[model samples]
Target chain A: MELLEYGFMQRALLASLMVGLVAPAVGVFLVQRRLSLLGDGLGHVALTGVGVGVLTSSAPVGTALVAAVLGAVLIELVRARGRTSGDVALAVLFYGGIAGGVVLLSLAPRGQATNLDAYLFGAITTTTAADVAVFAVISGVVLAVVWLLGRRLYAVSDDEEYARAVGLPVLPLNIVLAALVASTVVLSMRVVGLLLISALMILPSAVAQLVGRSFRSTLYLACGVGVVVSVAGTAGSYYTGTPSGGTIVLLAIALFLVVTAGVALRDATARRRHGRQVEVHAAHPHEHGEGCGHRPVPHGDHVDYDHDGHLHAPHRTGTGTHYDEHDGSAHPPAAVVPPVGRERP
Target chain B: MTDPAIRLAGATIGYGDVAIVRDADLTVRRGEAVAVLGSNGSGKTTLSRGLLGLATVLGGTVEVLGAPVGRLRERGRVGYVPQRHTVSGAMPATVREVVGVGRLPRLGLFGRPGARDRAAVAEAVEAVGLADRLADPVAALSGGQQRRVLVARALAAEPELLVMDEPTAGVDAASQAALADVLARVSAAGTTLLVVTHETGPLAGVLTRAVVVDSGRLTYDGPLAGAGTAGPDCHHPDEAARPPVRGYRLDQPRPAPDAVRLRHGSR
Candidate 1:
């Protein structure tokens, strides 16, 4: 209650909440495109922006937003032009940004290099009301663009060639995605810090990929996960006197590990408990195996015989020689996958 | 004659200035199933890409469904099933979700897919025998099923001209049969087909006409039966084709009569 009473803490919560919503909304596409580390790369460029702001006495978040977006466009250009050296090129550019930042900040008049700590590790608990307003405005823009182009973005990110063939504007959508990521990184700079900001963007999407069955569901779940961890991590930091960026990232990774273990556990349990259409054919005098005249089909680790209408796979588990009946399809139904936790009926 | 589904005349197609398929001329009337046969790197794929407006058309007119490929406004009018390798992503997508991309051609970027779109998607999935797995992730399906999903995605557009590149490549025999059955049904439904392949394996039956691409030109364009036996003075045609699954593994793609390969090799 005391923490919420402070104006600074209230601003921090609002800022982090916006960051939570905007980050994963954009991050899901990045995850789908397998460009999850673009967020981290842009963060390094944002650090240079902060250094520029320090030397020029300008607004750090605004400058960082501009700088990060420019960095993203350049990265996309390199990635588009040369697929072979794109990663290596982006890596060099990202470090150059940080190196440029360190040089600029140290040269700032009456500014210590130590001042970069707040930008690097986040100063969420000390954010001003003005900072929260910027976060809200940028978060609003990012979320609106995502709402308008969510399907189009997914179509391009999921398969660039197919989207291009079908005539979706792949290049413009890619640039918009890069811009959204840059805006998200800068907006959350005060909440999660530029150094760890990408974790906030990507981790929730990673967790959602493991949790949700489809892209739409994954995007929704990513937003939910993002908000919960961002707000909770901020609150946790306020109460425990810990850093918000570290706390939020750790919480997210913990949730990802937990969801992963939970999914694996559910699948294993469902497969064993479901029995996979096991039936007792002991009364039948016919034994289906090699040289039995019936067609044999390989089914995963075992072989199934095409007898009658069902694929009869033999199993020996203390019940004599039994057969598992499968539908005519070559592969068994995915009932063992255990649909999303909410969809389980 | 009903307007041809595709017409390319004196078209020079390639990336940048390379000109892989040069000065090509071809035409296909609506409802005809034509197979474009050639080995890999024979510019067969480039010819199809030119038709789709993917590769650069440096000179001459290239048209699809009676309109220029670039100016064709109706995305749903021409369904494209690209090579199977280009259709997948690392992300998890459901059969319904993947097939839903086909509707984007009609729906555009902002248009919501209505009930009619949903019906089209469902019909496409049913046509491919994947209705039961509509909600399952495509990644969970076998490679054959994944290829079938790509076909369904293309079919969801309900295009008048369906262009498929290597539809049967890399698939198992059973899946090839299943795919052949789907293609047969699609062909019977009156959609124009242009399938590019190195060999017409199980697809030999669905495609009645064959256009052989070699040395940067359509060396042979005739009935599927004749293209294979275009032999030293050709052979007789079989139309009384009962078992249509007989394959036609024609010439492998090699150096063109022109300098396309030489230019490529120098680079």
Candidate 2:
């Protein structure tokens, strides 16, 4: 409890909470649209922004926000200009951004060097007041946009063509979605690092989807799951002497697996019960020996050929039998027939 | 009528160097409902796009509402519902938001939607009988409902001409019927309609005229009944003055087996 009273711990907690709220909120749309890779690409671009800020002696988060917006705009432009698949485009942008960041870092003046490892894989313990404030502002703005346009976003995400035909400015809306994703990625980097940010963004939303019945429910549940994982992972790291960022991501993954397993188990149990009900109500007439007693013996005792060359047993009443022209019939033994009065038995 | 709503003289349409449709002379009267019918890849879409200024008119001239189609603004005067493929289903937007986009050209740069725009959107939604679904996510709606929303978006613009490309493709029978009924009502309300479609089932009685294109040429342009069984050139308006190509027929048999097979397969 004394450790929680410290300013750094509070700042880390606040930043993680903000990220946990914002990333999954944006990620619900991203995951539904199968644009999960876009989150990853934008996070990598945020790294380049960090490198640029470090080289120019500017604020890293501020620079990263601007860089992310620009990167998002470029991505939209590239997507509009080319016919390539979004994944392919994202791959190109990801590698290009990473290479650009490395070059920018190398070019920075020697005396103005900044730590790059912390940005690459986050150090939650090092979060400052400014970082917390920035996270709050970004998360608030993102939340506002999402709340205002949630229904529109849902429609577009489900069926872009239908949305456009109905008069939704699909192109502009897509750009906005991408922009939101980019902003969330940059802000989340403070808590989860550029490399592992998307896991925090996507995993919780995916887990929420397992238990959610609707789009709105999924988003709400995802935020809840995200907050829980972030707080638990942060505290566990503080007490257990583990890396906070990696621990949070692993925790989110574990939650996702558990949720998925629960859903699967419930579905399996329901299906088994349904199968039993269906079996009880179904009638079987061929179990009794009322008909098909005088048919010729089949070549195989378990199998017989029908007239159309299809196979069936002669003694099966409900199952029609057929005979092939190439096979000569042999008479069946009298012992195969049951006594006349024992039909039900 | 002051002037024909649309006129195309010797227009050639194609992508890059290959011409899919060429040397077409056509005119559409005000408030007319013209249905362009053709098999797959028969250049119906290209011709429709040309009228909307989406496709380049490689030669001759094209005009809309008495002005060159190139100069005609793309907003309220000429509303276009592109083929369903042009839009993505994975897009996130509500029916109202989708309808609201139809007002973009009218809104101008930096202009936001006002109460009037909202009213128009509402009216349009109501016109298509989708008022209850105005707040629904477009993906949750059935295919027929989605298509109705598209029509409502076009109606929001209150255009004099509404152009739809394959509006009923992949829709069920009821949806297709509902779409046709909506189109008929819109036409009755005085909007000229240019419908590009292969299946002419519901539009059979309502269409004012039918035009057929084949191999980059206008094969027939007349009343729907005058379209002969199968031919390369079959025109009406006179019997003796018909061109020699009018009687020239392809050897292909009527009611092609493949077409029959597909029809039965669909059922």
Q: Residue-wise lDDT of candidate 2 within B101-190, one digit each (tens)?
A: 666556643456789989999999887767866765554454556677777877888888888887877765655666777788889988
* Candidates 1 onward: DockQ, in order: 0.29, 0.06
lDDT of each: 0.79, 0.69
Candidate of highest lDDT? 1
Worst 10 residues of 2 chain A by lDDT: A336-345
Candidate 2 residues A1-345, lDDT tens each?
A: 966898888888888888888888999888877777788888888878888898889888888888888888888778766455765777777888888787888888989756677787788888888878788888999998898666566656755543443345567778888889988988888677888888988898888766553466678888998998988888788888787789999999988888777767766664465346435424433331235443433232123434333223333224342221223343221112221211110
For candidate 2, the per-residue lDDT at A114 reads 65
In candidate 1, what are the lDDT values of residues A178-285, reduced to their tens digit?
999999889888888888988998899888877576878888899999999999999999888899999999999999999988877777665554454343355575
TM-score on 0 to 1 scale for chain A of candidate 1? 0.83
| lDDT comparing candidate 1 with the true structure | 0.79
- List candidate 1 stretches off by more than 4 Å: A82-85, A111-114, A268-345, B1-3, B72-76, B85-87, B230-267
The TM-score between candidate 2 and the true structure equals 0.68
